[model samples]
Structure formats: structure tokens, C-alpha cells
Target: MNWNRYIKDYQSYLRIERGLSKNTIENYGFDIERLCLFLEVNQIDVSPLKITDETLQQFIYEIAKEVNPRSQARIISGLKSFFNYLIFEDYRNDNPLELIESPKTGRKLPDTLSVEEIDSLIAVIDLSSNEGERNRAMIETLYGCGLRVSELITLKISDLFFEEGFIKITGKGNKERFVPIGKFAQRYIEIYQKEIRSNLVIKKGFEDTLFLNRRGSQLTRAMIFTIIKSLAEKVGLHKNISPHTLRHSFATHLLENGADLRSIQLMLGHESITTTEIYVHLDRSFLKEVMYSFHPRK
Candidate 1:
């Protein structure tokens, strides 16, 4: 099959079968496209289905000069998934990336915000603006519920189960998890909806969407990053903070407060407990402090 047709099918598989996000699927497609471009440039006429492991390895080696080890490794991984999909569908007898090795790198932990830093960031929001109430509610839900930015923007009014004390969060791959909502978060959202949002004409497709931009459309990931970055600058906090920082902080703060890893894992919608265990590292000092204060053996 041609590279274009194969990539189209691969994207469909990622979306429908694997439940990957649009950005993730697009990245995978870009990796495959880059590989195809490299092969064409080098006068190699082999299609994706006919690509051999050796040729794939050569392509990776060529690209390694331009990218860092970590980024090169990610590209390799994305290519591997593309080939694996072909093998799974019986279009190929073998996987080209089966023997390819990912470069060895140290486990990089996600950055987190301190509770005081979070408060300081939120404190600077100019509540007098029309979108200020909405912004306040958005940040609270993001940090309080440990939501991915995608989950936060796509959040709907129907997702709020306030009477049940839970908000249903749609996570990666469209998986749904009911996370308990704090009263603080619920209160702000209510104020935004009833006081601010009720009067605006929400855009058609996003009418049920909880957070709307001034244009009444769903908030984009860029907007979320913009919101956080602007806030961080205003607060003069010298951390390279992102929306995910709030998420990591939510998990880390909970772990520091003596919440078990398993409970944090469930709330964060981690498919693997190992993913949640990274935050456990941040709580070590707190653990030792508790041991020294409360443990008789200490």
C-alpha cells in the first residue's frame, strides 16, 4: 500500500481501536511521514508494508544526528507502533521495529507546584473581568480533580454529579472515571455557570461544554497553557509550569497528605500503578517526618 493510504488506516486504528488523542495520532502520523520522506530522498522505493528492519534502522540512524536521544527514541517508538499496527492487521508478516532499541535514559519525573505556589497563582486572577469567574472555576477543577487539560476543556455540565459528590472525568482514550469533587471546586463552577455563563450564548457544538471561551467555543489546549503561563509570570514563580504541573501537584499533594498510592492512582486515571508511584518519591521526606514524630521505634 502507498504511504498515504497506510497512514490513514493507521490513524483510524489509533483513534477507534487504541483510543489515542488527536495530537498523539498526529505525532505517530508525522513519524511515519518523516520515514517515508527519508526513504524517498535516499532513492529507496520500498513502501511501508515492504520496509525491512534493516532499512528502518538505517533511517533511525540518519535522523539521530538531528534529534536528541530522548526525542530520537520517541520517534523510534512512534514508528514501531505504526509497523505493529500493520502486523496486527496481517498486512505484514513481520514488524520492522521489533528489534529496534530505545536509547537508555533516566526516568524523568513530572514537575509539581507547591500548595502555596498554587494559591499565589490563583490569587492573581483579576476577578473583575467577565471570563475571570470561568477561569477561576477552570483552574480549580484542573488542580482539584487531577484532570488532564483535554479532560478539563471537554468537561460538560452533565458530567457534574454534585449530588453524588463526584464529577465524571473523561480521560485519555475516552475512558471515564468518576472523581470526587471538592466543595471549593463545585462552588466556583456553580458561580461561573449561574452568574456568568448563563447569560452568554454558548456556541452550538459546545453548548453543553462547561468551560467556554469568549467566543463560546470549547477551550483549546493552547489556551490552557496560555492561562497557566500568564498566571505563572504574574505570580513571579520561577517554575516551568504547565497544566500538567497542576495535575502532578494534585497527585503529589495527596500523597504527601498520607493518601495511599493506589487511591491516588485511581483518582488520576493511571492504567498502571507504576505511573502513580513516581509521585511517591516526592513524599519521602514527609514519610520520614511522620516516622520520626509518630513511630515509637524511631
Candidate 2:
């Protein structure tokens, strides 16, 4: 099959079977497109079904020069998945990337903000502006719930369950989880909903969306990043903060405060405990304290 047909089929598989997000499907498609581009540039003619391991390795070698190890690893993983899909369909007898190894890149811990820094960042919001309340509420919700930017943007008004102390989150693969929202976050959201959001003319089909832009449309992920970047600059914070920074800080702060990993994982919507264990590396002293306080020998 042609590259386009293969990619389209793969995308359908990801969406229908894997339930991956659009961004994830696009990323996987981009990896294949990169391979196609390389093949064209090198005057090589090969279909996805006919591509050999040697040719794939050559493309990877060329890609290594242009991207970091982390990106290279992602590309390799994406390509491997595509080839495995082909194998699953019986289009190919064996996978091209089966023997190839991903580059060794050590686990990079996420950057986290201190509680004071978080407070300082939120304090810089211009509360007098119409969006001020919304911004504060958004930041608080982000930190309080440990939500991804995508989840935050798509959050619906119906998802808030303040009376029950929980907010429902639709995480990766469209998996839903109920995270407990703090009193502070709930209060700010109520304020924004009653005062700021109530004043706006919400567009059709977005009436249920909790957070919105001034145009009454749902907020974009880029807008969320821009908001955080502006707040970080206003506070003179040297850290390169993003929406994810608040999330990491949420997890880190909880772990440091003696919250269990499993609970944090549930709140953070991490499917694996190992994903939550990274927070342990953030504070060795906290781990030591836990050991000393809880160990029977001490």
C-alpha cells in the first residue's frame, strides 16, 4: 500500500482501537512522514510493507544527527509501533524495527516549582481584569488537580463536583478519572463561574465548557502555555515553567508532604505506578524522613 493509505489506516487503528489523542496520532504520522521524506530525498523507492531493516537503520542514523536522543527515541518507538501494526495486519511477515534498539537516554525528571513560587506566580495575576479571576481559577485547578493542559482545556462545567469534593478528568486515551478538588480550587472556580464566566457570551456547543477565551470558545493549549509564561515573567521566576510545571509541582509537593505514591498516581491519572515514582527522585531527604519515621527498627 501507498504511504498515505498506510498512514490513514494506522491513524484509524490508533483512534478506534488504541483510543489515542489526535496529537499522539499526528506525532506517529509525522514519524512515518519523516521516513518517507528521507526515502524521497535519497532517491530510494520502497513502500512501507517492503522497507528493510537496513534502510530503516540508515534513516535512523540520519535522524540522529538532527534530533536529541529523547526525540530520536520517540521516533524509533513510533516507527516500531507502525511496523508492529503492519505485522498485526499480516501485511508483513516480520517487523523492520524489531531488531533495532532505541537510544539510551536516562530518565529526565520533570521540573517542579516551590509552593512559594507557585503562590508568587498566582499572585501576579491582574485580578482587576475580566480574565483575572479565570486565570487564578485555572492555575489553582491545574495545581490542585494535577491536570494535563489538554484535560484542563477540555474540562466541562458539568465535570466539577465541588459538593462531592471531586472533579472528573478525561485523561489520555479518553480514560476518565475523578480527582478530588481542594477547597481553594473549588472556591476560585465558583467565583469565576458566577462572576467572570457568567458575564461572557458563551458560543454554541461550548456552553458546557468550564474555561473559555474571551470569544466564548474553548481555550487552546497554546493559550494556557502563554498564560503561564506571562505569569512566570511577571513574577521574575527564573524557572522555565509551563502548565506541566504546575502539575509536577503538585505531585512533588504531595510526595514531600508524605502523600502515598498510589494516591498521587490516582490523582495525577498516571496509569502506571512507575510514572508516579519519579517524584521520589525529587526529594531524597523526604524519602529518608519517611524511612526513619515509619521503619520499625528506628
Candidate 3:
């Protein structure tokens, strides 16, 4: 089959069988399209099932010049997945990337904010503004629940099980997890709902959404980043921070405060304990503290 037909099938498989999120499917599609564009520009006539490893090596070589090692590695991985899918369907006997190796891109340690820094950032909010309480609640929930920006935006009011001290979060791959909600975040959310959101003329089909823009609709992920960036500037914070920074801070702070990685893994909805173990590197002191507190010889 041609590239278009193959990609369409792959997209369908990812959506229907794998249950990948739209953004993830788009990213995978982009990688395939880039390869197609490269082949077209070079006048190379080869289909996905017929493409050679040499051609793929050429594509990787081309992208290595344009992107960083991390991005280049990801593109290689995405391409590998596509070829593997072909093999799974018995369209190919071997993957073009079978012998290829991803670059040695080291793991990036996530940046985290100190507890004082978090408090200071929240303290600078202009409480008199119409969105002040809403913004405050959003940040609190982001940090308190260790939520990804996507999770924070898609959060629904009906998901809040305050009596159970949890809020249901739909994470990557459409998987759902119930994360604990601190009283600190719950209180601010309640205040915003009662004083601000309760009065909005909300648009159709977004009635269950927890956070709304001034236009009375769901907030975009970019808008959440803009709010956090503006707040950082207002507080004169020096670090380059994003919504994910709060998430990293949440995990790191939990590790430092005597919480186990397993617990943090569950709260952050990490599918792998290894993903949650990165916080162990953030604070070496936490290791010593854990050793002394729980070890028999300490």
C-alpha cells in the first residue's frame, strides 16, 4: 500500500486499538509525513513497505542536523513504531530501524520550585481581579495534585470526590486515575466556583467542566501556560517555569517530605515506577533522610 493508506491505517490502529490521545497520534503522523516529504523532495519512489534502511538512515541524518539529540531520538522512535506496526500486520518481515540505535540522550532532571517559592508565587495574585480566584485555584490544583496541564484543563466538576479526598484525572492514553486533592486546593476551588464560575453564562456542552475562561468555555492548555508565565513575571521569579514545573515541584516536594516513590507514582498517575524514580535524583538529601529514618542500622 501507499504511504497515505498505510498512515491512515496506523492512525486508526492507534486510536481504536491502542487508545492513544489525539495529540500523540498527531505527533506520530507528523513524523511519518516528514519522511514522505523528504522522499518526495528527493524524487525517491518507494512505499512504506518497500522503503530501505539506507533511506531511513538518510532521513535520520537529515533530521539530526535540524533538531536536538532528544528530538532526533524521538523521531527515530516514532519511525520505529510505524515500521513495527507494519511487521505486526505481516506486511513486512523486518523493521527498517531494527539495526538502528537511538542517540545517547541522557535523562533530563525536572526543575522544581521550593515550598517558599511556591507560596510566594501564589501570594502575588491580584485577588480583586475577576479571574484571581480561578487562577489561584488552578495553580493550587496543578501543584497539589501533580497534574499535567492537559489533565488540569480537562478536569470536570463531577470528578471531584471531596468526601473521598480525590479527583478523577484522565491522563495519557485515555487512562483514568483518582488523585488526592488537598484541602488547600479544594478550598480555593470552592471559593472560585461560588463567587466567580457560578455566575458565568457557560456555553453549551461544557457544563461539567471545572474551570472556565471569562468567555465561559473550557480553558486551552496554552492559556494555562500563559497564566503561569505571567504570574512568574509578576513575582519576579528567575527560573524558567511552566505548568509542568509545578508538577515537577509537586513530585519533588513529596519525595522530600517523606513520601514514598510508589505513593507519588500513584498520585502522578505514572504508568511506570521508573518514571517516578527520577525524583530520587532531585534531592540526594532525601535519600539520606529516608535511610536514617527507616533503616535498622541508622
Candidate 4:
């Protein structure tokens, strides 16, 4: 099949069978598209089933010169998955990337904000503005629930279960998890809903959406990043913070406060405990405290 046809099928498989999110599916497609672009630019004629390991290695060599090791590893991983899918479907006899080794990039820890830094950032919000209450509620929800930016934007009013003290989250691969929402976050959200959102003329499709722009639609992921970046600047904090900084802080702070990794993992919607273990490395002081509190030698 042609590259476009193979890509279309792969995308459908990801969405239907694998249940990956749109952004993830797009990323996977982009990796394959880069390979296709390389083939076209070099006038190399080969189908997905016919592409040889030498051609893929050449593509990898070209990309390695232009991209960092992390990006190179991602592209390699994406290609490997694509070829594996082809093998699963009986389109290929062997994988082209079977022998290709990914660069050994160490696990990068996520940047987190301190509790005081979080407070200072929130305190800088202009409460006089029309969006002040909404922004405050958004930030609280982000940190309190440990949500991804995508999850924060797509959060709905109906998803809030204040009486039950939980908020339902649709995480990666459409996996659903119920995370406990703190009273502080719930209070801010209630204030915004009662005072601001209740009066707005929400758009047709966004009636159920929790966070709305001044235009009365769901907020975009970029808009969330811009909001957080502007707040960080206003607070004079120079940590290169993003919406995810709040999420990392949420998990880190919880661990520091005596929460277990399994509990943090569930709240953050991490698929594996290993993904949650990075927080253990973030705070050496916390580890020292834990050892002193529990170890016999201490």
C-alpha cells in the first residue's frame, strides 16, 4: 500500500483498537510522515512493507544530525511500533528496526514548584478582572487534582462530584480514574461557577465544559500554558514553570507530606508505579526525613 493508505490504517488502529489520544496518534503519524518525506526527497521508491533496514538506518542517521537524542529516540520508538504493527497484521516478515538501538537518554525528572511558590503565583492573579475567578479556579483544579493540561481543559461540570469528594478524569488512552478534589479547589471552583460561569452565555457544544474562555468555549491547551507563564512572570518566580509544573508539584508535595507512591500514582493517573517513582528522586530531603522517621539506625 501507499504511505498515505498505511498511515490512515495505522491511525484508525490507534484510535479504535489502541484507544490512544488524538495528540498521541498525531505524534505517531508525524514520525512515520518524516520517514516518508525523507524517502520522497531522496527519490527512493519503497512501500511500508518493502522498506529495508538500510533505508531506515539512513533516515535515522539523517535525523540524528538534526535532532537531539531524546527526539531521535522517540522517532526510533515510534517507527519500531509502526513496524511491529505491520508484523502483527502479517504485512511484513521481519521488523526493519529490530536491530536498531535507541540512544541511552537518562530519565529526566519533571520540574516542580514549592508550596510557597504556588501560593505566591496564585496570589498574583488580578481578582478585579472578569477572568480572575475562573483563572484561580483553573489553577487550583490543576494542582489539586494533579491533572494534565488536556484533562483540565476538557473537564466538565458534570464530572464534578463535590458531594462524593471526587472528580472523574479521562486520562491517556481514554482511561477513567476518579481523583479526590481538595476542599480548597472545590471552593474556588464553586465560587467561579456561582459568580462568573453561571452568568456567561456558554457556547452550544461547551455547555458542559468546566473552564470557559471569555468567548464562552472550552479553553485551549496553549491558552492554559500562556496563563501559567504570565502568572509566573507576575510573581517574579523564575523557574520556567508550565501547567505541568503544578502537576509535578502536586505529586511531589503529596509524597513529601507522607503519601505513598501507589496513592500518588492513582491520583496522577499513571499507568504504572514505575512512572510515579521519579518523584522519589526529586526530593532527597524527603527521603532523608523518611529514613530518619522509620529506619532503626536513625
Per-candidate clash tally: 0, 0, 0, 0
* Candidate 3 wrong stretches, greater than 4 Å: 1-107, 279-282
lDDT of 3 by residue, 1-298 (tens): 2799999999999999999999999999999999999899978888898886656766776777798889887888999999999999999987877656677664334457899999988999898986899999999999999998889999999999999999999987589999999999999999999999999999999999999999899999889989999999988888878887898899888878778789998998775565466433455676787889889999
User: Please, what is the whole-model Cα lDDT of each candidate in the order they appear?
Assistant: 0.83, 0.86, 0.86, 0.86
Over the stretch 1-298, how does candidate 2's per-residue lDDT look in tens digits? 2799989999999999999999999999999999999999988788998886657766876787799889998999999999999999999977877645677763334467898999998899999997899999999999999998889999998998888999999987589999999999999999999999998999999999999999999999889999999999999988778887898899888888878889998998775565466533456677688889999997
Q: Give the TM-score of candidate 4.
A: 0.66
lDDT for 40 in candidate 4 is 94
lDDT, model 3, position 128: 98
Candidate 1 lDDT, 1-298, residue by residue in tens: 3789989999999999989999999999899889888888978888887776546656766776688878888998898888788889999976767645677553234467889999988899989987889889999999999987879999999999999999998876578899999998999999999988898888888889999988888989889999999999999988878887898899988977778888998998876565466533455578789899889999
| Per-prediction TM-score to the true structure, in the order listed | 0.65, 0.67, 0.66, 0.66
Relative to the unseen true structure, what is the C-alpha lDDT of residue 184 in candidate 4, on a scale of 0 to 100?
94
**Decoy 2 TM-score against native:** 0.67
Residue pairs clashing, model 3: none
Q: Give the TM-score ranking, best first.
A: 2, 4, 3, 1
RMSD of each: 12.0, 12.1, 12.3, 12.3
lDDT score for residue 132 of model 4: 93
